[model samples]
Target: MTGGTYTLLVEVPEATTISVGALGDQQFPAGWYAYTGSALGTGGFGRVDRHYELAAGDRETRHWHIDYLLGHPESRIRGDVRTPDSDIECAVASGLPEGPVDGFGASDCDCESHLAYAETGAELQTAVADAHRQARSE
Candidate 1:
């Protein structure tokens, strides 16, 4: 679907630090991350597909903070939780636990950070999916 909010579930196999554009260097522990974002622009959810491409090493241009993490060969997109036709990016993000980075994926908004992290993939995925469902229900 188009024009919605989504949370990308990403996995980093090993701990490493990457420099996010303008955000400076940040350390990412090997685990799972849930990044929430909005797709309300002209292209809508096409942005999500582009993210997948970046994770797959098919795209090189880093347009967003998430791009930097996804670009790492060891980091990959595992899945996504979407709320089609919904505009609850902040709500969903707020519901998730705090992330290591202070402003990851939240340059345009006031969220502490749109990315949340967990020690395991299952924990992060459950939290991300539940957050989206809770936000959409509200």
Candidate 2:
């Protein structure tokens, strides 16, 4: 199994409010979002696939904070960046811009959030890639 840290690039078409599990209802502006997390569990990177399923409406279970956002009808998975065989989830997440929802996906760590947001896909994508590169070098 190939386990590592990964970031999911998400696009929200318009302003929307979604109840994010324990985080409750949170506002997400229309823009791009980057959610970072580790796939180091026994399931490995298969966790990423499950996220895709949620975004595609093929899955309904919301186990993680990211799942709640991805499950939203307006949320789309634009792309993803990955750093295989490494556990740099917090590093990469810390490198990106702060997310709207505090504690989103950082329940198990010290990070304020494992999610970040930007007004454009290009900006967030570039940030995600750079975060991965920076995390890997450390």
Candidate 3:
């Protein structure tokens, strides 16, 4: 499968809490978020497409922890950084600043969390890009 790692830059306009499936209720501060994930399965990058759909309110199924956050009314996808043909999800996630919500989108890995938060979209976007670049270099 031609899969890779990707970081979705999400924005939360207002602070709120959402129920993340088995993760239960979690707090989310108002800010920009970077969620790193792997698309190494047979569907490959299709998973990223699904995330956008969910964020756009086109989809209702919540299969991942990120979905819960993205499904929130005030949350939307700002952009994404992708490292094609690379499985550096964990590396990229660890490269960015730590996320406040523990275990978000990190059910399968050893990462503290696959989600990072920043007070501004620009800052989070830059961090996500840097993480992707660093992961690619490594």
RMSD of each: 0.9, 0.5, 1.1
Task: Give the per-residue lDDT of model 1 (tens digit) for 65-117.
Answer: 99999998889899998889999999999999999999899989999999999
lDDT by residue (tens digit), candidate 2, 1-138: 898999999999999999999999999999999999999999999999999998999988889999999999999999899899999999999999999999999999999999899999999999999999999999
Q: Looking at model 2, how many pairs of residues clash?
A: 0
Q: Deviation in angstroms for 107 in model 1?
A: 1.1
The TM-score, computed over Cα atoms with residue i paired to residue i, of candidate 2 is 0.99
Off by over 4 Å in 2: none
Best by TM-score: 2
Local accuracy by lDDT, each model? 0.92, 0.95, 0.89
On residues 49-84, what C-alpha lDDT tens digit does candidate 3 reach at each position?
A: 999999999999988999999899999898888888
In order of appearance, the predictions have TM-scores of 0.97, 0.99, 0.96
1 against 3, candidate with superior lDDT: 1
**Model 1 Cα shift for residue 66 (angstroms):** 0.4
Worst 10 residues of 1 by lDDT: 1-10
Against the true structure, candidate 3 reaches a TM-score of 0.96
